[model samples]
Target: MLPLCSCAVIQSHPTVSMLVTHGPVRCGEVRRAVTTTSSPGDKSRQRLRSVRAGAALTMLTPLCTLVYVATTWSAGNRPAMAMICVSMLVLAAVALAGAQAIERAGRRATVQMAGLVVNIAGFTALALLDGGLKSAVGAYLPFLVIMLAVGMPLRPFLAVAGLAVAGYWTVAIIGGPAQMSYAVIHTIHTGIIATLCLRYSAAMVSLQRRLSDLSRIDPLTGCLNRRGFEERLANELAEAERTGDSAVLLLVDLDGFKEINDRYGHQAGDDLLVWTGRTIDEQLRTHDAVGRVGGDEFAAVLSGIEPDGVPVVLERLHAALDGVASAGIGYACYPAEATSPEALKEIADRRVYRDKVDHNRQVPAEAAVAGARGDGARRQSAKVSRHERRRRAITETGRLGISTPGMGLLYVLLFAGGHPNRWLMATLLTVAVTLGVTTVAAAARLSRSSAAAMIMPIVGALQFTICTVVVCLDGGASSTPALGMLTTLPLIALISPRAVLLPFAASAFVAIAVFVGVSSTWYAIGHLTSALVVSLVCASRGRVAAEQRRKLRELSRVDALTQCLNRRGFMERSTAELAHAHRHRRDLSLLILDLDRFKEVNDSEGHAAGDELLCWVGATLRERLHPHDVVGRLGGDEFVVLLSSHSAGETDDVAGDLEAALAERIGVSVGAGVLGRHGTDLEGLYAHADAELYRRKLARGRGRSRRPAAPADGNALVA
Candidate 1:
């Protein structure tokens, strides 16, 4: 089993291919070629360190051997002692040089082989000079033999182990009064341990491969990640340049995927993304590369394919996607379009921009479209999903705000007085602890939504106030229990912030002043100090946590460049608004828009201008729309707007206004879909709006194609 497993691993990894073709001890190119935690350069540096350490160890071994010999040197050991001295001096010298030599691949293998020779000599000396396996010195022999396996490759490590076995059996048979059975049993035992050591080396190699995969491959779709994709693309480009063939790059932005997430939820979106990856892979040959470049966006490189071949591949991909996703393909052929990869890449990108702009100008401006969600951009926000809410809360703080009622428990115990007061205190603590647990349990239901943040804080503050009353009724502010109520305020602040905390704390302090009288003023010092200290601590923590939460939320929901809601956030907000409209049977409309000639601007002026344009678009829409309007970037150049309480006519009016406004700054096309006329929900409205946008783009293109007969009247008159 061990040999078979070792053979399997060796055959699978080309990095270790030298083991079969070359001698068993030769070094192979196992750097970045094998998947590992460290890069090829890092691994080379590590080998240098390992060689240095081995040199130090090699020197130490002779010193240890000298000590053992001095303590128990019999007359039979003189020759073996001489052999040990010679081998030790030679080993140490080689080890020192090995450190520098190991940086080079072939020399490193040779150094490891030299170290193995030292190990064999040391073990052989012990096995011959000592009283076989029964002697203490002989027992040390097996350990030294296996120790060389650590940095060595499998074949080399096993070779060293085999040498140890032969030396051990020879010593056992000759020096242990010819005990054959004992030699066999002990040799077998040593073999087992060596086998385990060999397996460890293989396991280490396997672990490295897994880590490399994690870095290079997308976890969701199993496609090359952005960095990996770029690398593969560069390779393909080089190949195409050398072979006199062409390559095509397609940048596919899934149409209306955000709506699918809003309607069916995130799991459905995730399934779609995974399915899309598989579908894209199926359309390409093995050499072609596809990657999930960004949210709702996929980029593909088909090498050695002509310009005509590009459409057939895209058509097959469309068939594979069916109606679930509509791909917008933009490709530039190699040599035909541009010779250099970077130039061709820009051309392809501009083509994608052209595609989006063309589609926008052709589509009518009065339709709402439904978008299907991919798995990557499918999950709803915390408000829409219970599991998502809890996950965010727990991941952010690592607990369910457990300290909300921590000080309340101390108040319950201190205020144990008369039956009525005891009953009151117990009731408050019970409610406090229960609410504390409930708050955590309800994290799944809580989010940035204002109502959710207040639930636990309100409940906690009320419980604390009720307990304060109980303490004051017993003995006023002078009572320890009453003072503990001040401590509880800060605890509430820890879970909440100034919003619910300060108001509740102020009211409780006022109640103390009313009940305890002017005499309790001096006693207020302890309460004030406690409140000040605790409140400061809790407030500091609260602010830090809030900032972290804010950043995390933005990362998840906001577009990095545009600072607008991403597909998921927009879809969730729009989905909720659409549902509300449906319940009330009120009119609602959605507007989808794309910037015209956005690519030309990017291609001519550079990406910075394109980015600035997108940011300006986001800011402008926000400024123009009503407060309740939802705006989001649906990746690339597409944008969507959800107008709450707006009828179809109102939606069209707003969209036209937006188009007119942007007309001065940028080329803009708009499409509007009403809830009642288009499909009622996010999906229907999105689909209809998208369809309208496409129709308008087509109409514009045809109008441009038809040139008027301008010269007929003037030229005819002149003639």
Candidate 2:
């Protein structure tokens, strides 16, 4: 079945409904949100073309073989040869037709099933080609090999194998006694080899599948990792360009996730991330892609969104994140705002940070304090930070732990066939595969992602150790030390190269001592020395690249002027605080403030003095509020604050304090709103406070209009 989804929207002037679009993804599967990614202009159609080309290639081989056989060997029974040639051509055409149908439907199962039927038919026709089965068997065996060459999946391959065995039995029945025994033995040999080929093919497919998943997925949340998200965005960009369509890219970052990880424990933090991913996925359509691009950030691709539809789609996404987490979303449209994927990403990323700043600036007083404290007073798990968890992962596993099964299979192959440890290697491969799959479920259940990073490294290390011992037990006959060196080398580069070396080297020394004895200590020393040299080179290159990226990310969100959290940073902090406050039934408030007559001052004084004045205002506000309080400027002279644990009265007091401080200067108007009373939403809170500010400004305007009949010169009015 072609899995697809449709969305319908009915809009009115007043309120927009939540059910504007129906998506295939239900709520709560954030990390596992599914997207088609393939539109009319995507690579899926290109692949169909490739498959058609393959079909043609497969067709030519059989056609040439049939014609050659008919011309060269159809001596006495020309009628039988003619019949066989016709059957092969007809079978080839039918097979191509079946493949074409599958290409249209894009179904792999059809490929397997159709290929099986065609292969069986062709083999049966070949078996009956000559004067008798005896003469035909020799000619028919080559076609059986050709049948194996068709790129059918495992099930159809097995079916084809069974049919070949059946054909051989029919041949044996039609043959003389001597021919019958020879056919029986040949069939048995063919069956064994086919079984092994099938097994190897299955393993290769499995390995490819797991590796592909690793590149695209976030190991912890099971969402699209950064690389995967970027690739999909590129595809979306291509689709939009080719088809003249429009799509939106939303870069979502969790507000206060660092605090959550710091306070509630990394485990709680991970659960929150999982919940966030699932929530975003739930809000998206089947054609939308949600990816965890940063530590606490996710990006989404919304296809089929009209310019007007952007607001509704964004609203749905916000609603999903309401209580669990506060999210700052930055989005850009293709063909509208950006011409390329990188441009789209840059625009969205900048906007997301700006939104985060707005959120942070409006954060309630107490929430800011709690955030600064960096501890979940309500539910702190074992003390673990995101960085520490990462440190442990690399130091322990030396892996991001994305593709353990694939890596382990390589280790198995390196251990080779003759080693007694080959079976041991096989067991390790199975365990590694099982471990990688189960770790996700386990982490979800445990609410700890550290386990995800830790398990695979241990399994890999253990596998290496076992392989080494098995090789040593056989008197170090194999290149055991060499395999050990290659496998153990990742441990050096993935972690702090210098830091991890001592323990790794010590462990290697003991193992080598136990196995090779004192005479080969030079081999062990050489291994460690050379490995260290390589590790240092890798570490130098890796750290520089990692550092450059880290700095770029920091530069992206930092405010150029006031040096406070910019608009996006404020929003990033505030959203999570608001959500946490709501979830816990804690008091929360918003304060929107703006300088009176700031534009007049800018006109009178130079723009430089105006900038200095704005800087002073930012500094003064930061000083008056607690360290936990987040302050942000919404361009121009407007400012906002998010106050956690602040009641209506406390909200008023804070607002009044800031206003009194500013009264000596150009003056500041403050508007306050409390959660549950003023509004629960970030946008609503700002609107409510801004409304109050406008009300006060209007009152001042009326008062000033009545009292101020100033002289034209203005000097007499002051006196």
Candidate 3:
């Protein structure tokens, strides 16, 4: 009794029912919707294969029975047996031929159930006509049970199994008490097989469903991951196209997400990502889909939305996101902005990038005004303490470090029991035990990653030293203990930074030279060469990984348009400058500059021209400012400069010169915040400078005096 249909039975799984119903539609809803609404290509292919296989099995079984009856049965019995087999064979052939059509018509289960009924009827006829319960044909009943139990729904399978057992039992009872005992044993055997096969089938189906869920879902966010999102989006777009409806593809990226990770920790970052996914889900319709497409980036596909309605949707989404961290959103409408999902994604991503640039520029100015009105800016979380990172690193390193040596100790005692150097082996075991215990204790007490970093390499070195001594005592560099030395190289590679690699390799090479001097064997030479190659390979890989990390960090910090520090970079650099000023009592000043009537430039001369002007400003500032001074475009038309070691008077002079230089080409306004007179921290300095800049812009707009006298401190100046 094969499964009529192998499709997932979502409602049958009690586990799926336990999913929360009230939250934003998550992976569960998405999975259920896709499973129900879409004919997935993989599943369809699998269904076709299952149908073909079942058909082949169906035809082959009856054909084999026909041949068996022809060879073994009497001529009188042969005719009836042959008739039953031929009927099943014809049914199987029809099923095989109609498999594709059945699938297309969505009547596979109906056809399959019909086929099962015919098969059972044929089997019962053969068993009764041939020799009743004692006939070999009765054995086919259990095989039918096995087939039905595979993929058939539970209740149907049980029904079939019970029917099979009853059919066999009835035949046995009819054969009289002489066959009753045989029937009892056969019935019990068939019952056991059916029960086990049913249990196995249930477990397999459950596992298959679980795997499906895991593949689609992002475990942390409980939303669809990239694969799931793409599948859902593709199906949605297809439906929209067929219905002549519209859809919206929205791409969202979290601004300053990396800064959040750095300032807080990865745990907080993960929580924020989860929050972002949920937030996006909350904003969309239940029919719409949201997915985490990249780190700090989410994508949503909204069906049945017109182009005109997109703006309202976007506005609402932004409003919801604005309460938390700033977000950049870009959306494309199907058949309006772009036809295909890929095109829509590309256009949306470009818009998101543009939105992020605009957000960066506007937020700083807005935050400044908000702060001046006594609305404190959102405070950043304190950076993860150095001690905490170190402690975690140590603990992680110890798990591997302690376990390896403990295993080695066991290996020595278990496998090297017959070695002649008993004292040396004993010494190795003691050393390994000591190292494991000490490493565990040290990891417990250690709070710094640096300490863990140091301890690990030292542990590796000690392990190598002991191993090296054992090799020398046993059989020199050519001995089996030589391979143990190779293990230390990877440990060193794992724990030690790039700087340590060279020195360590060099020292190892010198040690190898001394060992070679004592006993120069081909094995020794080969072993030494292998060690060098392994070291080089690890070094090269480490270098590449380090370089990639560096580039990613730099990309995160730098502005793409201006090639200057972005907001995150500016804040980081400014924080360091402020700390230095406080530590050494050096003068520091902050200048906030806004392009006067910058929107006019864009309005009169396109965005490209405005971008060109912005780029020129960045270049001009980098030229005029000292090599040590910092320059950054905060976003939009706003820029910030930190003049290092500049006194209040010097800062004012520099501000005036910068304003004059920029004014020669375009209208510009500058405001300066002196070290002590403004505030101590970076936020305080930025707030004061932003306020002054805002006032200067207001005056310029109101047709009032362009230049105001320097304030009492002489450091507060408007240019």
Candidate 4:
């Protein structure tokens, strides 16, 4: 009933869980089992403990045999009973001592065999003394088999088997027909043990092989992983040090992997990586080892190579990699390039990085060349687009009625005429005229009404300067004096009511100085005085006009909210860019961005949030864009960008980058349109880009937007 109860309880729960629930009692049992199994000590201490345990067990075993012998002797067949008793005791003691020695000696092959020899000797003696087969010699066979199998190698197992067979034959012969049954039983037992030992040995070998394979191979690249490489490298370095041979280490990197992933799909990039790995493997020598150390990075170790040969090996690798698209190779050698395996790897890795940098530097030039060969029409269209952009800028500026300060300097020169400092006068005149003409032209295009007013004063100033210069150059009673007085008189009067007296005073001082230097009469002095007065008055007036013009231009060109260049400023510069592109037959691209659903912000979050969004977008764009790219807000939620020196494809790339950059923030759709090689002029490009932008917005709404489309002719439109 107790056994039945125990079985039921045990069946209800796992043995381990039950044991844990039993707490200290079960824990004590487990602890006792562990202590019996192995102990921490010097070999002798552990051996002593094992010896004691074995001796006690052996003693008990023989005593039990004596009881069996006594029962047999009690049946009245006691002739050798006493001798058997003495023999059993002696054999038990001997077995105990032998086990102790085996444990103490740590079971070296020689020592274990010696112990086996002692056990065999004891058993053989017992069999011979007990009349061989007449005794239960087969009973001792199991003990011998266990000892030999547990403590010794295959040699001992074979020896035990041989000895067991020999002992069986000896018993059969010595005891004649009386011990035949015992011999048969002993033979059967020995055979079973040998078969089990052989099976266990095979299992161990199979498991060891499986572990070795798992530890060494990398599943991804089917090469060594970092762990395997480190192990292999250590072994190689040790071998090289011992053999006085050198090996080369190489580090290879894939260049433009990130760009490829961004432009193409990651799946394509992965295909590229696999292709690169195979190419590297094919290029390496059979003796060389390669491993993928990191993403887009690989390393190789080459043996049987001298330090000097390292460079040659690297060159070969480089050439091999060059054939593989977007691959770069770098290498270092042992015993020359570096003294240690780690150092060599470090040097190789650094070289690989430098190679990648050099490879990256060549990309732009390569793209430009490709663009030139592939898309001549797009290139022409890009130029026309740039020209239109410039014209738009000029028109915007004209509407603002603004002039830059640089223009005012021109007026100063025109009014100065042929004073002794005539070159200064000419320089100022040129600056003013250039500024005024450019500003007026831009204004006229943007706003005819404002442009007309701005143009009049500029034209009048130009005509006045021309007349003044001609009169002075002709040595006639110079209209310069009168023109100078006309320009300066107003400024002085405005600043001070008595400012009219300043010209008279300035003339008097100049005349007095001239008289001192040249002994001039009153008539000559008066002529000189008038010229001096006129020059001073004109200089003051020119300065005042220049200041006013500069302020106006700044207000026109700069965006009031963001303080960035306004649409007008961008157009002006874009026009000049177009002209340059047309002249050089280069490509230019335009990007138009209309923030999708921007009105939603104003409607839901209020106008303040909408304003914040605009400011944030503007700041973000400024930060993310390249310094050379032109950025402008084209009123409301619309913005425009002009990219120079880029092919239609390249422009698409830039636009994609901008879209991705913006996507990270506000939930807005960005659209890009490109025109080049006469496909569309600047205005047409903008319209096309805007249409594409709307298409993108529609696509986004339908969840159809994936990667923005590259332009049909390698020009791109993105939303």
Model 3, span 1-719: residue lDDT tens: 11111221111222222211121245324334324334466557656766666676667557756766766665357887888788888877887888888777887777666666776677777777766643545445654554444335788777667766777676777766665644554454344434443553354334334434444554456666555677678777888888999899898877655444333323344556656677677778876888766546678888898989989988888886674546789899998888887788778877877786686522213232233223221112112232433343354344434444444444456555677875676677468657756665776466633365566767756765665565555555433334344333433442233636445544554565466433333234434443443444334433543344344345445665677776556777887788889999999999988777665565455445666788889888898999899998755566889999567779889998898888866888787788898977665676577557657766677212212432223121110
* Candidate 1 Cα errors over 4 Å, as ranges: 1-462, 473-486, 499-524, 551-555, 579-586, 594-628, 645-647, 653-669, 699-719
Question: Model 3 RMSD to the real structure?
Answer: 18.8
Q: What C-alpha lDDT values do all the predictions have?
A: 0.54, 0.51, 0.59, 0.47
lDDT of 4 by residue, 232-251 (tens): 56556766776888877777
Q: Give the per-residue lDDT of model 1 (tens digit) for 221-260.
A: 5565454566556666766766777888777656545444
lDDT of 4 at 525: 36
Taking all chains together, each candidate's TM-score versus the true structure is 0.42, 0.40, 0.47, 0.35
Q: 1-719 in candidate 2: lDDT tens per residue?
A: 00000000000011011101112122323222223444565545655554554444445424543554555563555566556546645654664566557666876345544544554455455455543333422324423432242233555456655765676666567645545544543454344333433443343333323333433454445566555676677767777787888999888867655445324433455556656776677677766877765546678888768767888877787776655577778889877898887788778777766666675422123343334334222211112122432433332332212233344345446435476666765665465445545544444333344474455446546545544454454354223333233323433353443334446545765565566653344334433443343344334433543443344333323343454554445666787788788788888888877677664454355334666787788888888887877787643466777777456668888888888987767688777777789676776676566557656765776112111221122111011
Candidates in order: C-alpha RMSD to true structure: 21.3, 19.6, 18.8, 48.8
Worst 10 residues of 4 by lDDT: 1-10
CA lDDT of 281 in candidate 1?
A: 68
Give the higher-lDDT candidate: 2 or 3.
3
Model 4 misplaced stretches (Cα beyond 4 Å): 1-123, 130-160, 258-288, 335-341, 358-719
Residue 682 miss distance in model 1 (angstroms)? 1.5
How far off is residue 208 in model 2, in Å? 29
Model 3 worst lDDT window (10 residues): 2-11
Which has the higher TM-score value, candidate number 3 or candidate number 4?
A: 3
Off by over 4 Å in 2: 1-418, 436-478, 481-492, 495-502, 514-519, 645-648, 702-719
